[model samples]
Target: MTTRIDRASAGLPPAAPVRAVHLGLGGFHRSHQAWYTAASPEWGIAAYTFRNTELPRALEQQEGAYTLLVPGAPEATEAIGSISRAHPGADRASWSRDLACPDVAVLTLTVTEAAYAAPERDADSATGRLLAGLRERFRTSGAPIALVPCDNVPDNGAVLRSVLRAATRDDLRFSGWLEEQVSIASTVVDRITPAPTPRDVREVLDTTGLRDEAPVVAEPFSEWLISGDFPAGRPPWELRGARFVDDVGVYQQRKLWFLNGAHTLLAYAGLARGHRTVREAVGDDVLVEMVQAWWQTASRHIPIDAAELAEYRRRLIERFAAPGLRHELAQIAEGGSQKIPARWLPVLRAERAAGRLPEPLVRGLAAWVAHLRVGEVRDPRAAELVGSARAADPVRRTLSALGPDAGADDELVSAVGAELATLAKAGN
Candidate 1:
């Protein structure tokens, strides 16, 4: 079952000193972003996982090469030659040490919503980890690296800057130091990427006959919209259908509203309905209708026109329905508290402000809060979070416990509470 890489599968690896450095080197980043880089052999990317040694061990053993499969009924792996090295994030000594090298120009991050999560700016939860990471990158060495945050937070570059500013310890010199160097770029990345399961590994092995210890599998569709500057340069991803626009906000709004917002809906409602994967949930007629209804309302407000929105919607439906993509309910549920504010709150706030409260969106929010009551899922890293949960009103309880934003008036709170009560009594 151990097959040497098909030399024809991926072209010759590009010449030395890796051009890009990726953080949070999980399966999704491999299948999605790395796949983009692999399409062009020139941009050899050396990536690292966040504090996980196994990824480094796997990559180095393979000589910085692995299989990336486009997930489907019959999975197929394409040999990738982009990665030249891998390391663990906690090994910041090496992590920081690598960034200083002049060859590394672009840095991409896929550290999940929790990394950039600040549910409410006013709350004590906000910190400038991304900012600090960049400032430190500059402080360690004045090497100009493009800080591309692949995480999906609103105005992500701005958020990155704000956090770095916040973490400067109220020190003007440090703030000045930050302002002088570093180009914190923002990007909106899309792909129906799911964590690989044993079944997935089996398929990759069976079809490709490649003994890939760490293969990344995702659906065919993918996108990356970069809004910030790439001072030190970046991958020519646009050649392979990526759009490098002046403002990715319109695109982001279209996506964040339907794609991500719909995901939140399915995660909670789909879980309640006994559907496990996002694909499974969207497949059910009842749930699909709910998704459609929710999207119709939200899409109307998207910055894009009707024709473009319609096409995006169509593409979204097809992407969600990708049977090969096993986007887990639990993975979607990972940082509910962290993600709720950025993806869900804006829609809720806009609707309420317009005097039209979106019931489905409210249901999605309630379902997430209801998940807190179950306690079957455990995020050990988030041990500090679960302990502090409290509630006066169910709405107040959920928001208050979330560590940010008491959000709107009593009317909205009651609406959320009523929905939560319905969900609780419905016993899903």
Candidate 2:
């Protein structure tokens, strides 16, 4: 029998005080935020999942210690102990209590973009639960706290503030208190952490002689760019390579359009071409050309220097082609309704407004339409998207489903439709 991972068995130090609370605990959070926090042992995270209990339960069994496997020339693994407490979403009492504690200075979120769309009245949603916690904090200590959103949505800080304002509109007292006490911080986080497979667990036992049920496998690359106020104070995340900038908008766009947009394109176009993993798709000459063409159009809109952008793209191609990192196209393809608008449409709109129809972006959109017709779509708006795919005017209806502005673009609609026909003829 392998030795189970616990604080003592892993030779970890005493658990730090829970100075931060994180929602949507998952592989990305573990490999990114929690890993960064581990660099500062004084700041521990009390992590809660949105709905899943198995991850929390598994972490709880191991005293919130897990292995982070970074695969490279010589594979490296570390015991991440930044998460001091792991609680299921059902444990609302602990969540409220933790938030109310004056010592908990920051509340970080990794809930996907879809969670933000949950109805304001739905108290069970991620934002709803946050509102409840804020109310508890207001009623108790009324301490200033930062709300850091680490998702891929554009202007995520302002977006989250908007959602919270709408949720608390009727309650003037709570709303006022919220405005006075809360600071929403936007962040651009990047790390390629694939869902842990059983092989990861087995490898942990084989290499480290410790059985970690919740091991996370990630690429060697990781980045966290933060912009906002932490009135009550926060960890020295800067020591761990986190940059605190005045304007994260440019960086956000660079990430959203360059990194995430490419991923979305590869996910759809790659899958349509019968590729499974990012590595496999990026290796194909056809898919690589598609990606390069899309990058060319997207680069025109980004304000960054040309050399830097080229270097970024070069590094991205290397990262995408990282061997043994099974970043699945199907996994990246989830929630296209939320992702496409954020990732591709901005470039499409800008290119169209410039009197140039971007063929690569149009092809990417067409690939999405084709995928919706036959791929395994796991989106919050799946029914509507799949329905739109089957419509007589599929491209028009699909664009409409994405957003009103996209649907109204006559030139874009024609281009995407034409590309879809070509894709169908080519069996893509």
Candidate 3:
């Protein structure tokens, strides 16, 4: 008997190239980056998950292919031609052998924001994993490649080196080889593809009954901005509408402030108002206002203009309202400890340094902290910061978990604590 997934293949297509190898195989990778890579005939990316090999195992059984459904005004459909190869990254000993391929130009990463920091961080951080492989290439094959990080950090390439090469500080030769052979690029990736629902499962299956392991459902919008260096080489992602800039920080800020920042607002406030999905929360005028307030407070500092921000919010509302997409607040709010410092507090610091604390932003911070206290919240980063998050001193706790700079001012900490007190009982 065919499973529900296998029995529902209506419009699936064949596989594409296998030039690219991805480290973190998640839904976002399939929906956003892989979709773009599939659009081009020359670029084929192989993906690997961490220890959970369900994605790779399923797709490989289907010959390294999958589907991407765009939930839009009419809901568009197409067979992606992007991924052609995939495996698990925990198979590191063997997988590292494949990295020796000179043509595999971009080693792209979408590992969650939490994974950015070095374990037990200090002046000397973790960069050995990167150094070891690149060093092998320099010594044996003289091949070079670009190490691209597709996460949401400020300077992702810089962070990757700081953690990967600087972690131990024991090997100078490996560090020198990494400097000579490797190129770390920062990329801003954007797309709002939600997790698959039962309806989506049914929608993907047709008369063909073809099952896919990693079918992605998303909004029609997508964007990617790459910077740093593409030493080995890169595909012409520009052909498919990707922007290549020298300073991806501007683009990163654009996506982070508008897309991710707004996502946090909808996740925290929207849920408090009894919304499960972003669409349901944003559809309500009240929840919409909350997000608007968030954007307004954050808008004061982003590089873009108010008009542009307004336009972005309008599109975001439309995407949220689309019943076809079912983005989960639980998922968005999963990494508060990891994301708050880099995503929310940066704007907070910016706004505060200029002498004005945005009320809505402050409210958001409070809500997130309170949510952590509720004990039902499923934030993994919260688990990582268990001790600090529970402390009576909100600023001390927040700064300790988030970073050193997060607790700079007593007034700011107290204000966040006060707002959190108001919203403590609320849950959406």
Candidate 4:
């Protein structure tokens, strides 16, 4: 017999008042933020998808209750009851209303790096619509709210502020009000939640006996570090393993350079070696060596202590090698333009300044160039960069992706060129 998840069926209390509005209602948010908010049952979430209506509709159908499958030797399924409403990104009226509500103290976002692009002409963009919602709320409530961005970007709160300010350049009143009323909380979020496969859906049904249409699957590990002022109160997320600190910058950099940088290496270099998923790629000796080299370079720059960094890297290996998680290399490889500057180029520049070529970084850049050359990419800047990736001279092509300073540096250029040649010979 099949069961459905809801307040009545699950024997849980009714959904709480809408205290938080979440942008980008994807699997990561479900597994990470929603899971955290579940600890504070009084602070319900009204989540909106990023231009995707299917998840919104499906979650709404289930009364915002869905199975969260945590993968391990024996995967466990738990029904999450933190969401009060599910909405499509285009539902501007509802978004505005929710934001205007005085009780809605916090707005959390996971709308990826691309959504924050200063796209003024595109009114449908997440940034544009968020500006609209903020404008609407400012007029009605004049209330303080926290904007916690859970994207992978460094200083994400500041990034969100910059994007919103750019989007609202014409409206100084809205911009000023945003400065006065909104507090952007920078966050470092880590979780590996792959898009659910059909097998996962079947497994959820079999385990929970629930016909969940919008189930989310995640690895066993999750971490959240947040730092900022929240004038409007936030959920007691600290109770749920979230660290609220005075500074998230160090943690943010650690995550970006170590975890994210390693992922970028695996995505490009690992995929070049014909591995499709992070698990398979991470288990490879050569790929592991490449990641280790990159980590050695990255660790030199990140301010975390040696023991903590070592522990983090060790945990990363265990997490990445988890056989049940199928995090795709192609998925990680997406948005290389936005991702590389944050993940790799900084380490490359730091290493170069310290008089080191950084072999893993050079090869990673080469892998990205080769990956671009191999086929079509999904990046917004793909057309502009791919042609450059296929340029005749390796240095010229590498410079195009990395920029003019790296181009002007003789040592760095030579290393990049040599790596590109080596990769070419290897047929990557």
By TM-score, the best candidate is 2
Give the least accurate 10-residue stretch of model 4, judged by summed lDDT: 70-79
lDDT score, residue 230, model 3?
77
Which consecutive 10 residues in model 2 have the weakest lDDT in total?
69-78
TM-score of 4: 0.94
RMSD of 1: 3.9
Cα lDDT for residue 61, candidate 1:
72
lDDT of 4 by residue, 1-428 (tens): 68776766755578889999998889999999999999888999999986789999988888899888876534456888899899997787898899889899999989877778665777677777777778788899889999999988888888888888877778888888888889999999999888888888988877777788888989888899988988989899988799989889889888888889899899998878889999999879999998988888888887788999899999999999987788989998998988988887888888878888898988888788888888458787888778787777756655656578777887766777787778788883
Better of 2 and 3 by lDDT: 2
Q: Give every collision pair in model 2.
A: none
Q: How far in Å is the alpha carbon of 297 misplaced in model 3? A: 2.3
Instruction: State the C-alpha lDDT per candidate.
Output: 0.71, 0.90, 0.70, 0.85
lDDT tens digits, residue span 353-428, model 3 = 8887677776777767666765456656556455556766754586556666657667677787777767764433
Better of 3 and 4 by lDDT: 4
Candidate 3 residue 221 Cα shift, in angstroms, is: 0.1
RMSD to native, candidate 4: 2.0
TM-score of 1: 0.87
Highest-scoring model, lDDT: 2
**lDDT, candidate 3, at 181:** 72
Tens digit of per-residue lDDT, candidate 2, span 1-428:
77899988987887899999999899999999999899888999999997788999999999999998876533568888999999999999999999999999999999887888644758888898998899999999999999999999899999999999888889999999889889999899999988877777777777789999899999988899999999999988878799999989999999998889999989999998889999999999988998899899999998999999999999999999998688989999999999988898888888878889887788889999999998888999999889999889999998998878888888889989998998899883
Q: How do the predictions measure up, each by TM-score?
A: 0.87, 0.97, 0.87, 0.94
The alpha-carbon deviation from the true structure for residue 44 of candidate 4, after best TM-score superposition, in angstroms, is 1.5
Off by over 4 Å in 1: 4-15, 73-76, 117-141, 169-180, 378-392, 402-408
